[model samples]
Target: MGEPNKIKLGISIGDINGIGCEVALKTFLDNRMLDFCTPIFYASNKTISEQKKRLGLEISFQGIPSAEKAHPGKINVCNVWKENPRIQFGEATEEGGKFAIKSLRAAVNALKKNEIDVLVTAPINKNNIQAEDFKFPGHTDFLAKELGGDSLMFMVSDDLRVGLLTDHVAVKNVANEITTKRVKDKVFTMMNSLKVDFGIRKPKIALLGINPHSGDNGTIGEEDEKIMKPAIASMFDDGHQVYGPYSADSFFGSGNHKNFDAVIAAYHDQGLIPFKTLAFGKGVNFTAGLSKVRTSPDHGTAYEIAGKGMADASSFTEAVFLALKVFKNREEYAELSKNPLKKHQLKKKTKAQ
Candidate 1:
């Protein structure tokens, strides 16, 4: 009743066979989480009960017919799936894949209708989930397809933030996808996300070089100079503080990444390898350039550690916190834009104006 902050959150249960349900339950067990926001889970009640039992936690779940009934201190399960094909830990099945997809679809619909403030998704298995009915390389792509196009995937943490230009693609095809248009769009998204999602007034960005030692100035490869450099120059011309085409090998070592607010990598491994190596269980996977705020943990569904209770809930918790922060930042940015202020002004006015 304290001012009715009324923050409603939508959580998509990832693969039931994985630890998604376990972490989702554990993360909500903290009454402090309810104090910040009301979590509305898109999963079956049976699955939630099973997961709680599996984790040996006596968490209580309440079924809410709609978001309006959600309250603090109690999780509201929407129950997306009717049939509970209880899956064994660490094992993958078509039913589990379908159930996960159903939850995702329900969450997306709620997002599209503006029923939820933000979405915090758990990790899912890509191979098992990709079928004729459900076809997406990952959650980001699926969310993009559902919400529209032109979304960027950025890993977020307090110290280091990295954005991937191309995600969930084979290494051989990554080079072909790194076109000038893609780079420009991704950079624009990254800068906007930092400003609007993370509340950075003037976001500083570092672009990672695709080759070793930044192509050694055409000695190794010309993609960095030919494709990446021009994109950075164009962004500079527009008056954004973006730098680099730095070698992936030495960028982190130089500590230059710490200087910038975010780093843009050329491909999946080029960005994630450094981010995960540094972030480990701390980073949150934030999908930028979307109409709605969405975040997930940086790591995947660890089938190996699935029922062992070894899966750390820290990253998943961070994902929830970051998603809420992004949602709040977006609201703040919108308010500021409607009544433009002089505290911070860009040389080139935003299209939002």
Candidate 2:
């Protein structure tokens, strides 16, 4: 009954037709993984077993009745559904969709009860999982609704941090959602998460323009000049180190983004296209503004090559590493906020004078 040495990780085994189960097992197979976390897949043992067989991977699976039974060096899975799911390598089915949803819900519930430190969700097929029985655009929207939190899908790689102003929205509708208030809120959320969650203080941020060449002073589009510019100006006055409505075309390569901590992308493709292009299979998708920390690989359920043993685990690893870092640093960040070093330096200087 002593305190468990392992941190319980609630992992949602995303779309079985894709690489979710594959990567989840592979990531857990690293024996050294026990040092950081003990994974509790919110999935049935059958689903994980089938995935391992299809991929021709040799790994052990242990069924645990509850989170308290979880142990390091073994996957402690809480079976979300009792029925055996019909899983095709690259095809979607009703049972598969339902199974994925069940697992996700279980993971979310575990997170709610404090049974897990953080939730590392694998990718899910949004279209397939949106049938009558299952619903959700993706994990971000689903978790946001479940946790009653405003979720911001932010993608991060080595040096790039991109937050979309509008995620999963139609291209035509993106412009309408880019209001000044919305922009300010997302910007502030990203800034706070950067400092508090990611240990980045004095976060320099860049705002992507809603137009070509940042509207060229109201020629291409007035949103940049009218909406984005004023929001950034207001934030600056409020003591934030933010800049731009920089032209999306050339801003990324100009080395300006490298100086800032994160960039707010106007829409899904606007930021993710460039981000994925540069950090594909390397970036981690994090849900900012959630009460609890959540992250996932910055890719989707690759149904085309599902069960082919071809899914890259780099993104998954990065996501796990990021979750651990964020969890551990939360306290450090709070301490830093309570006793800011910059304030102390200014105090010493004043005393000397």
Candidate 3:
């Protein structure tokens, strides 16, 4: 185990009944993980221990009172609550949601307070996690409010990067939500993320059509022609490498997404369907354009395979790696930006289109 600048990684145990803890815990069992960052899980030691014992895995971790006490090259469990919630492997209960929120809130507070350098969240059940206090659809919305930036749900892998125009919305409401401002906001957010987070100076961006055959040139639907095209053109004219309203039906199957650095989809499924198809078990959902860096596994809570030891930790592991990578990139970018000449030159080059 090696120390990585003593970077403290804050983790939120997503759903108590899910595979979040299993995969997250499995990822760190490899002592090599300590080479990259120190990790702190925002959950009770008892809760984590119960899951570990249920899965028959041995992990050495110390219980800490808060993120400030996290040790380098060691697993630190921040006890948000001392009492253990009921361990129903596949069942979603109010208790699960309550405790999950407890962990998430604690972790987010730690993140906002700068006690942790970055965050990699575990999977949470969307419906179960919904309540009066935590009424948002998912992490992106919650983080946007907490972190304060135009957020984009960026799905990333070695081969592809996809950002959504709108995520966690209804089909009917999606078209209504796809305004020019939103299209531009999410795309520009992705572009900036590509530059600053992924370290791509010149990133080519693509947009998939909201309608089949890209509205068949106004025959299929007007969203592609009316909404997406103008946004793409505006960004392009502003000196950004933005293009399309390409037919979504054939975009991925025809291998068109490989042509660009990133692709923007009209909605959640439009982006995630192809993304998951091509990179399931390997993709990481990065909440780009936020004040704090947060990433999660592409897949959600695997309730069915919660405790059989069948859950794959690949995506969760990638989330950790990505959170670290982005943190380093942002650090390097910030340092480079300190040079006024370099900063001015970069601004002139990109120019916020």
Candidate 4:
């Protein structure tokens, strides 16, 4: 077992044919990571062994039947499935998606049972992963349903944090989905996440406009003025330090986003396009508002470079690091909130008087 203070990180191997296993194994290769958390990978030994051989990596993993048997100081692989599916690198097959769902479901169950402190999921093929058992658009949606909360797709890095208003929606339908209530809920979620998960006591959030030039006063579109502006006003009236339906075109160009603690964009591409451009290979996709902590790399399954031994593992490693950081921050924030020093401060002031 790891130290009492150490966290237990549960990992779900995404598409078996994707870079999920590659990145997971590569990230755990650094022995120093074990000092902070014990990792339990929800995958079979056969899958992990195949990937290790294909990548020609020297790392070793301990195969266990469940998270309960996971040992510290070693990478643990919990066998979610016994059958070994064909490893087709760079191919999106039904078998690969099936195993990905199996791994994810198993890890999510462990997370719900409190066996794992945090979850770091690898990328999954959104199309092939669809089944009657797993019908959600992506990880964020699936987690929101399973964990019973309105989750926000919050992307984070050292310098920037971006959250989406409407995730995994088509471009044509993005505007219709941007309702006053939706905007308000997303902003509230972002504000709470900034304080509780990131340790920001008072957060300033920026909201992006839904249209070109922010609708140019309705010449291009009116969603920015009609829906977005009112939502910003409502949040402000509620005492949140939120601002702007800023023009997406120049928000990042002028670097105004640096002034705020977080940004909320109207759609997936509106937010993620700039985020990936700024922190593509190192960004972490954090699902805020869930009862449990879950993070994943910002990028998707790289079918082109799945087994080339050239896939960059920076984003995946950063996801794990961010998960650990957020978990610690949440714990500290909880303790600080539970035993506030306001009473003590007042007593000290009385003594001085």
- lDDT values of the candidates? 0.85, 0.83, 0.91, 0.90
Q: Could you give me the TM-score of model 1 versus the true structure? A: 0.94
Off by over 4 Å in 3: 1-4, 340-353
- Select the stronger candidate by lDDT from 1 and 4: 4
Per-residue lDDT tens digits for candidate 1, residues 47-72, read 78778777888778788766666656
* Model 2 ranges with Cα > 4 A deviation: 1-3, 131-134, 335-353
lDDT of 1 at 288: 92
Question: Lowest summed-lDDT stretch of 10 residues in model 1?
Answer: 342-351
What TM-score against the true fold does each predicted structure earn? Answer: 0.94, 0.93, 0.95, 0.95
- Candidate 3 lDDT over 1-353, as tens digits, reads 44546789999999989999999999999998987899999998899899999998899898999887777889999989978689898888888888888889999999999999999999888888888778999899999999999999999999999999889999989888989988888888998999999988889999998888999889987888888888889889999999898889999999999999999999899999999999999999999999989999999887888888999999999999999999999987898788778867766777765
User: For candidate 4, lDDT tens digit of each residue in 71-178?
Assistant: 888899998888989999999999999999999999999999998899999999998999987788889889999897889999999999999999999999999998
Query: What C-alpha lDDT, on a 0 to 100 scale, does residue 96 get in candidate 4?
Result: 91
Candidate 1 lDDT for residue 81: 69
Mark the 10 consecutive residues where model 3 has the least summed lDDT: 344-353
List all candidate RMSDs to the true structure. Answer: 3.4, 3.3, 2.9, 3.1
Whole-model lDDT for model 4 versus the true structure?
Answer: 0.90
Q: Say which prediction, candidate 2 or candidate 3, comes out ahead on lDDT.
A: 3
